[model samples]
Target: MKLSYYLLCFFLVFTSCKKTKTDLTKITAKTIAIDSTITSAAAIDSMVAPYKEKLAAEMQEILSYTAKDLVKNDGDMQSSLGNLMADMTFDMANPIFKEITNKSIDFALFNYGGIRATIPKGNITKASAFKLMPFENELVVVELTGKKINELIHYFIKNKKAHPLSKSISLIINDNKYDLKIHGDTFDETKNYTVLTSDYLQSGGDKMVFFKDPVKLTKLDYKVRDAIIHYLKKVDTIQTTIDNRVILK
Candidate 1:
């Protein structure tokens, strides 16, 4: 009789503890106007003031100088700024890649849209680098087959936009056919070329699908903005030109 009483109590407790499902009944939304009506907290502002001042000083720190303005729209196939960007990226990221893999990056490429701002004919500061590459894109190396490299060339030609390419590559488009060279060597389909680019592009950003699914992919954990800053510090003056890196005939 005691055991039966205990079982009944246990059943009652279990039924009482059972959870019931809740259903969504109504939804509401409101638009808050953020005009001058909202006042910032004095404590919050005080806490952020020091950090803001420090960042401002660091951003304005001069790193290098440029004689002429470096703009991305200077050329149809290649721009002075684009060339500099590619070259500096290669120069900065190549050593890291080589140290890690004991292999050199064949070339560097970046989209035209990636050049967010141009360097004016004056001092180049840390702020300049940040402005040029505002995104937190890291440097990455992707070893692609020669076929994919060919497709990349075709894409550049089709777009006719100033896509930054390192000096290691020379592409001359003739009608539908093109002549390509890497590191002063004729194009070789049998060999794989390792390209240095931003992680964004490696993931096929800007419709550069050719960069996706490479033979090998390695992230150097280096930001493009940092690379630009480092390069600026190393060089006293920025020297770049629109060479025969890409040509259409």
Candidate 2:
């Protein structure tokens, strides 16, 4: 009887110590939707009100004056607003670039999409600039070859939008062929040209593939909006007009 009890206890202990070989139960997560409406807390609003008011006041401060209305229109080869934006970028950025690299920017180019709003006649303020340029793009010089210039002309003809180009450049689409002149001189294939544009173009923005790999890339590290603001202030009155910068027959 004693031997039988010991054997039964050993059996019980062995069964208890044996590990189970069963598979783990799978877990599936289910989503429970919650209400998405958000309400502002008064404590947060009170903390932000003062800074917001100051920003609004600063944005409305007058920077300069406009002699006439500057509007951007599609299908037009040149627009007052486009010319002003491109010229101002060149004027403001080239000098600083020259000061650093001792080389001047041949011309400036910006996409029409970059112009977000229009400027009416009379007081030009920080608000107007902010509305015009909302992006914090930096000014850069892209040194492209003459072949690249031809590519740029072809690009213009293909798109046919009033992309901002400086006065120094004159592009005429003749017989579906590109006829372009830079700085009042015929393009020289053997020579290199310096173009002023935003780093956006440098990174292949707006399908500007030619600017992707330029001979040299120089950054002014100045925001384009800041350049426009400074240019507006430097020039007491803005008298930019639509010239025949781009003409097609």
Candidate 3:
């Protein structure tokens, strides 16, 4: 009787294990066209209407005016939009950075791809600023030695993209040679310079690894977007141009 009972229990366990196993089946998908005529549900629209109203109000708030369009371009040098962004980032953050560390930043550097949208000529709104810089990248200062600064220049020459640089520096790329000026002075190989940039680039965003291993790192606990917004609010007009700051031959 005991042997018969044990045999029945073993059979029950085996059946349970088999029941848990699933068989793989080949399934095919049928392509379906989207319904272009579909409308939003009334209930869903009603629920979202208030939030949409608030968003519209905030986005429409005028911050400043632009006399001309500022756009990001793939030129050999920097674009108007790039210059504006880099210069504003430095201008707004310089005081805060100086207050914190008692050292003013030399210049600001940013990627051209960072400007997501162009500013139309006329009123500049909060929405436009947000469109330009959608990321919440914070402001950071990296203190680099003269050697690393040279690397920064070389990287700029190799990558001929219109990476935004503040007017505090000047760069002229003539064929294989480059002339770099920091703070209106010629590039000094013995001096250490403090550079202001987004935290994203400080950690090697856009493959800017020259910013790594800095002599010092300072976080102003401020967002670059906020700095832009602040500058726009204070300035009545936004003016930036592509001049000798970045030259390519």
Candidate 4:
């Protein structure tokens, strides 16, 4: 009887240990599967392979094309590329502002940081724009008082960097003073004006607190880079020139 009791106790303990091991194995297997799902280089590569191939092919085509007309017109590839982006800045902002706000915007401000590179002359392709503006930044409209608009201009000029302006904006910079003109009209401090800019600037990325204090803000679903790409596709023929919208001298 004693031997039989001992045997039964041993059998119970053995079974419990086996069950615990099985549970642990299952938990470890599940953890490994979850980790593999996200970190698997092969899976990621498979998903991105097609896009990579397409971009490579497009870039190759652009490189092969000669810019006979552009060269004859004394146009460089980088200038043309800058014009493409600058033009898109206006094209995308004007119509969208009319559609959403029903009020025409005074001008659009694009951050200098947003422009990655000059579009090379010749065959400008979608892939080239991607390389130029890699970030997936979207367009945003911020309504600010005329005072804030002057402040924004001062910030841009003080930095001495290039920022895209959609409409006619002139800044007369003197010793610690700036005279700003928008569309041939003097800026009114009491009057409200809508300015189209990127979400990045609105978020105070470039020390632009004016947008942060905007009376109204709207975000568009369109990415700025993607907008440029779409614009390029629509207008196959591109002219490269310096608009000098942001003049240093």
Candidate 5:
């Protein structure tokens, strides 16, 4: 009787251990499968598509009404449209981003290609901003010296059609040459300056490699399209006036 009891206990313990191991193995396998599914390129793109579409629609609707009505004079539509784009870039960088990174960003540079179309006269909707910035690019901050900033200006001048800028910075370009100054002070080559711009620029798109050499870089989770949408929503009334911030000669 005693031997039988001992044998029974051993059998039960062995079975329980084996069952636990099997359960763990099953769970681990399931987890791996889930990870693999998420990492698939097609799956990721499909998931992102809906949001992109929604944003594009909203931006398009907004542009249809806003710039057309606001722009009065001839050729004013293009100029006003550019100003709005610049304002969107600046506003997004300032208050909206201050919470994420405590450091105050001195300037913002927005690429012109990102602006899709001129806003038409009337109501500006979320869809309009999306059309302007259709890409899924996110906001990225870079730190660089004044020398690099000058180089960026030169890059812009060289690639006039592709390079568009919205800056809190002040720069003078004469005869395809540039003199860059940021804020109220001249750029100090030895000192570092923090710049807020899109990830597209940081990634060497449109030949903007100046951001690549930053001592520190930070990417915000917020999308650039979303930022423009938020700004447009805040201003129920749209007005397009030339700030003369960008001069193309």
Candidate 6:
């Protein structure tokens, strides 16, 4: 009888201590409306005011002046703004690439869609640079084979858009055949050329797959917008023109 009583107690304690699995039977959610009912926190506002004021002033500071509006669609195959962008990239990135690899960049090519905004005929500021290129793309030089260079030329010819090309290349499209010149020399299929472009394009962006799997790729670790800002700061006046870098004749 005593044994039976102890067993009953032990069974009761074991059953009580045993863990039971929980299964979610149902879930309910509540929606909270966020309207004008919320008020700005005074402490947070005070903390952020000083930084905002400094940034506003810096953005408005004049960097340079332009007598004529620099736009990307002002010409048939080239524009003032596109030339400036491509030239600036070549000018800035070539030095860095030379320092690292001891080789000069053959040319620069950037897409028309990459130019975000135009420089109006007035004072240019830091805000202008930001508006023109809000992306954080870095410059890279890719050593492409002569075949790849031909492919690049073909791509440009097919697009027929005013893609920014530097003065180093003169591409004249005629009928189904095209005449190409690099650095004032005729395009040679036996030589490899180093081309300057952004990291985005190097990764095969915009269907420019030729940039991938190059002979060599050297990153300049320089942002395109910073180059523009640097160029703007160094010049009192910004002057650019549509040249014969590309002729669709």
Q: Pick the candidate with the highest TM-score.
A: 6
Residue-wise lDDT of candidate 3 within 130-234, one digit each (tens)?
998999999999999999988988888888788899999888888868888888889998999999998899999999999987999999999989999999999
The digit string of per-residue lDDT tens for model 2 on 1-249 reads 999999999999999999999987998999876565766788999999999999999998898998777898843767899999999999999889889999888889889888999999899999999999989999999999988877877787788788899999987777668667888998787889999999998799999998989999998999999999999888888888867778877
- Please provide, for model 5 over 61-120, each residue's C-alpha lDDT reduced to its tens digit, 9 standing for 90 to 100: 643245354321223112465556655766776665577677777777766666676556
Q: Model 4 misses residue 197 by how many Å?
A: 1.2
Question: Candidate 1's residue-wise lDDT over 1-249, tens digit each?
Answer: 999999999999999999999999999999999898899999999999999999999999999999999999988689999999999999999999999999999999999999999899999999999999999999999999989988998898888899999999988889768999999999999889999999999898999999999999999999999999999999998899889988878
Q: Which residue runs does candidate 1 get wrong by more than 4 Å? A: 1-31
Separately for all candidates shown, the number of backbone clashes (residues 3 or more apart, or on different chains) is: 0, 0, 0, 3, 20, 0
lDDT of 6 by residue, 164-222 (tens): 99989888889657899999999998999999999999999988899999999998899
TM-score for each candidate, following the candidate numbering:
0.86, 0.82, 0.84, 0.68, 0.65, 0.87
- The TM-score that candidate 3 achieves is 0.84
lDDT of 1 at 133: 97
**Global lDDT of each model?**
0.94, 0.88, 0.89, 0.67, 0.66, 0.91
User: What lDDT is reached at residue 152 by model 2?
Assistant: 78
Model 5 score (lDDT): 0.66
Q: 2 or 5: which has the higher lDDT?
A: 2
lDDT, ranked from best to worst: 1, 6, 3, 2, 4, 5
Q: Which clashing pairs does model 4 show?
A: 77-121, 80-240, 81-119
